[model samples]
Target: MSKIDSAERARALDLVPVSRETAERLDVIVALLEKWQRTINLVAPATLPQLWTRHVADSLQLVPLAGQVTRWVDLGSGGGFPGLVVAAALAEIPAADVTLVESDSRKAAFLREAARVAELPVTVVPARIEQVAAQLAPGVEVVSARALAPLSRLIELAHPFLAKGAVGLFLKGQDVDNELTESAKSWRISSRIAPSLTDRSGRILIVTSAVPLAPIKEAAGNAKGSTHD
Candidate 1:
């Protein structure tokens, strides 16, 4: 098995250079994940040895993709992948905030503790994504999810935040092409996909706009003299 030694891990961390304060906060989160993983399965057992590469580095790659956005909402934040990790980076930005929505009570509790211990600019919302999106305060700049749902459902789930002008940034597996095809069946969306730095089989999906195909078709049909060739 390939292994990443301390030197290698340090070099890997260099790929995304965070402020010293952000690094300290991430350290706290890593410690918490390790402690909690012993009993709660915060991460896959097979990946315990590669925690930094598999989780931390993977999450950190999303920061630059979000540009200058300061407010964020992470859906189904099971172990606070990009949410808490991103929050660590956001700590350096003024007025930054990251809200992590997790439905699992145990996971939510862990997320709360991690944020508290790390002292990150994060809010742990212990509720289903459906229940909290509408209640979210305005001006949220981005919404993200990891290993949560397919592209079609993700659009549905993130609709509230998107409607309010928040961009969507989702971490996805290699099957993303299939998911995007499925989503296109029902929705008209303007989006872009980027390769993931952490894993060859992973992808980053950024969605700026999503509208239902039904309405779009109706609008096209309603336009006077606008006929297909």
Candidate 2:
């Protein structure tokens, strides 16, 4: 097994302290991710060295934002960022669970195995975000996506859950201002931007509501015409 940076793990725990059991589960997830990377491009290869601070800590920061919400749906849960991470923390909470949606079959397989190994309450769905949006949106309390899409399209993809009162917590980069501006053209977003605990350039968008300004068909057409993220 490749040795993880102890200092980095400590730094991440300081940022978002978790129970020992949860921390252990997260460790297992990290190991699983590292193993899977050999065969699948789970995350950016360059980011592996700083995985604890960059990905794990970044994902851990989202846990407190949901504030006891147990039912979560992680859209585009590539490599199980906040999804599995959230599930790790919520393991102690009664009835807490996270549904991870990943379209790539290989990645989905990794998620299932990781969740199993970590003993987290997670359901891995091997399907596209659009295909299962409505089915999964019904009772989800929180919706999350990291590095998935632009704010405009993300809102579109997460609309069903948001409209039904699920709070959306999306991790974004420095271009957030531009993305927010672009999103405003299509959606009336009720949100607040929170500074990231890990990266200075990162921002966490907490969206309480998002009502589309365009007609449904128009929005669908626009989504189809735009480049996929």
TM-score of 1: 0.88
Q: Each model's TM-score?
A: 0.88, 0.93
Instruction: Please name the candidate that would achieve the greatest lDDT relative to the true structure.
Output: 2
* Per-model tally of clashing residue pairs: 0, 0
* 80-156: candidate 2 lDDT, tens digit per residue: 88788999999988898799988877888998999999999999988877778888998899999888877888898
Poorly placed runs, candidate 2 (over 4 Å): 1-4, 218-229
**Candidate 1: deviation at residue 46, Å?**
0.9
| Candidate 2 overall lDDT versus native | 0.86
Q: Candidate 1: worst 10 consecutive residues by lDDT? A: 220-229
